[model samples]
Target chain A: MKVFVTVGSMLPFDRLVCAMDAWAKEHSEAEVFAQVGETSLCPANMEYSAMISPSEYRDHFAACDVVVSHVGMGTIITASEFCKPLVMLPRRAELKELTNNHQFETAKWLEGRPGIRIIYSDGELAEAISKSIGSDGGSIVETGTRGKLINTLRQFISN
Target chain B: MKKILAVASAGGHWTEMMLLKEIFDGHDVAFVCTMEMYRSEVAPNRFYAIPGVSRLYKRSIAVSVAKLLFILVREKPDVVITTGSAPGLLAIFFSKMLGARTVWIDSIASIEQLSLSGRMAKKFADLWITQWPHLADPVDGPTYQGSVL
Candidate 1:
């Protein structure tokens, strides 16, 4: 149905945006929206924006059926909060895409989490998107815990 | 009710702070972060944005520290917590000066060791938690608390 792809706020992730565009073209029925960051490649198949304001950012994620993002913590946490299925593409330091390889480390650490699919390359993104949409974001996330983490927070604050 | 101040510089730092959302839900929570085109997780009244420290350049941290100085005075929170970057460090620094308890939960992305900000937080944070088991050093104030990821 609806897909939102975010490459995060700082770097260019044209590889992801381009792959997602190809995926959307194949799907035909899926609606794709992307926050492309400072990338040069423009997508002709999907709705694209360089960046969005705070309210619009949340609204887009909330409305999307699935969130495809770089392995940045911001994107992952936001996707988890919306209970949206996620396709995380880790940026590689060897490729000069990021300052370091921490995103690769994050993907390694997050391997078994529910409803999350980690793609090492653009080739894997289409399948993850297909799987996410097919399951209606049910593969990685099950029950939404709106207040689950807050309880721990309140306890920490009182002490 | 106790008031809390949450500060994270954005990206992984902000994400880590938000993963602890339970702590801020009902409290008089206020947040400070790097400038972004995104909205706050909480209400607008509870959020502040300052320039993020450029990891490549040390100058940005000083600017944000100056901005955070005033907010710390105004909020006068009972406690301050962050999943850190330089902004979080500055917030904690000021919070400590203002007599607020401070907590630092290092980012999970630091698989090998504590981040630069996490290391800086050691002298200030009342409690320091690490997501990775290997990074925990109880004597140094960083303890294993499982993961927020």
Candidate 2:
């Protein structure tokens, strides 16, 4: 299995990266790559970099079977675009991992969505990863709403 | 062709703006984002990178605002649009001061409610939008047209 982990460009999510790295250490069957941002924590078991170009990010996202990351909307949208199962761990405000608790709110709203799993604790990371290995990925269907939005904006701009 | 300033902070806001790339077709478009590296994504199109700030980063907000004002003056776009966070909100505010039309698309990630920035953008945005239809209200608005996601 190929796993791509991202913590976003703005902040470091050491908790998520550490959990995934621990899991990677025990699982020789999986190839794990991470975009860890500018963090002090280095993953001993996974290939990681501070950041990757947007195109390179897309390339890794397209090639991955599963994605593991924080409750970032970019990651969520990209995972859906590529039909990849996603395992999300939200950053806590109290932990000072993020500016606020918006991620927790996103996680709450995303609960029970198909092919997406949200785990509050890193303890469940292994189980989530194990369960997602062979599962069929999920995709966001392009809806007519998108076209209408484009048209609305296009018309508004032209006028 | 109208000059359009497309602004978004990095991460989801930038992602959402990219997904709406079609809106920029045939228009004179310039992009503003938080991450300098994203210049490649909108290559050949004019791109500007500004310092990203949030409410928590109170100190940096002034610096970001100054940069945004400079861009707005230089571009003098006909319209400014963003899938927002703090920086986008600032762009919308400054764009309006410059007599430019502004659109604010609340991030899809704000499924529970409009983001803090999105909520504040309501007053400044000439056309406010929300991805979730349920969040739209005729009285206050954040009209639901469709989602970029």
Candidate 3:
């Protein structure tokens, strides 16, 4: 089983790296790839965890058993579009890890959506990974309406 | 009567707000944002600058409140629309208190769920817009506008 994790901008890179390292140690049979942000807090481990660029971001999602991420809007929808089972950890405003508590809200919103799971802490993340190991990403998202949303934006801007 | 004050924290929020700039072209339009190094670089419309709110500075709620007062007294917009981070929350809260129509647009990236701001905004907003229908499940009311931007 393959697990992929992406921490987009505005998250605690060090904590993510620690979580990934701990997870990899416990599940040595599974292959895990974690992409830390530009300013990373990555430990010295090339086998399981490493930093990656945005260009290479999508390729891993295609093959992973589980996709873990911070609660960024971009990362969440991309996971859905790929039909990947997603687990998200919200960046907390109280922790000074994010600009605000918006990630908490975003995580709560996606808590039980189809093919998606919200993981509040590092322990929950490990459990989500266990659940997704053998499972394939479920149903495709109907993003056809994204065009309509864009159209609405265009009209809203043009009007 | 449809004066709209769009508030954000620069970057994606500002870019997202720009997507709806045309809607305000025909109405009274104003912009609100935080003082950021990037804000000077981004070419947002002449906007009102508010103190930034973030997880690190949660204690700065007093500063946020003061800034909100300044904005409320200065703009006095009839409606407030936000694609939020933190400053947008201040706008929504003040808008509600001052009797202005409030609309909150959950970001397109919110496919998995509503952000924390979206949840609070959903409660009191005159219209809460979400690009993802799944978000409506947790919203307490029927005022979801289904993604105006």
Using lDDT as the measure, which candidate wins? 2
Classify candidate 3 by CAPRI docking class: incorrect
Candidate 2, residues A1-159: lDDT per residue as tens digits? Answer: 899999998778898888889999998788999999989997999999999988889999888888999999888888887888889999998988987788998898878878888999999999988788778668743455788889999988998
Chain A TM-score vs. truth, each candidate: 0.84, 0.93, 0.82
Off by over 4 Å in 3: A38-40, A45-51, A139-148, A157-159, B1-145
C-alpha lDDT score of every prediction, in listed order: 0.77, 0.89, 0.65
Q: What DockQ, on C-alphas, does every prediction get? A: 0.45, 0.69, 0.10
Task: Output the lDDT of residue B68, model 3.
Answer: 78
For all predictions, the C-alpha RMSD in Å is: 3.6, 1.6, 7.6
Question: What lDDT score is found at residue A58 in candidate 1?
Answer: 88
Q: Point out the higher-scoring one by DockQ: 2 or 3.
A: 2
Q: Residue by residue across B118-148, what tens digits does model 1's lDDT show?
A: 8888889987877767888767648776667
Q: Write the per-residue lDDT of candidate 1 for residues A1-159, one digit (tens) a residue.
A: 889888877678888888888888887798889999877887989999987765677899888888899988777667767778888999887777777787888788778787788989898887787777745443342223324434555677888
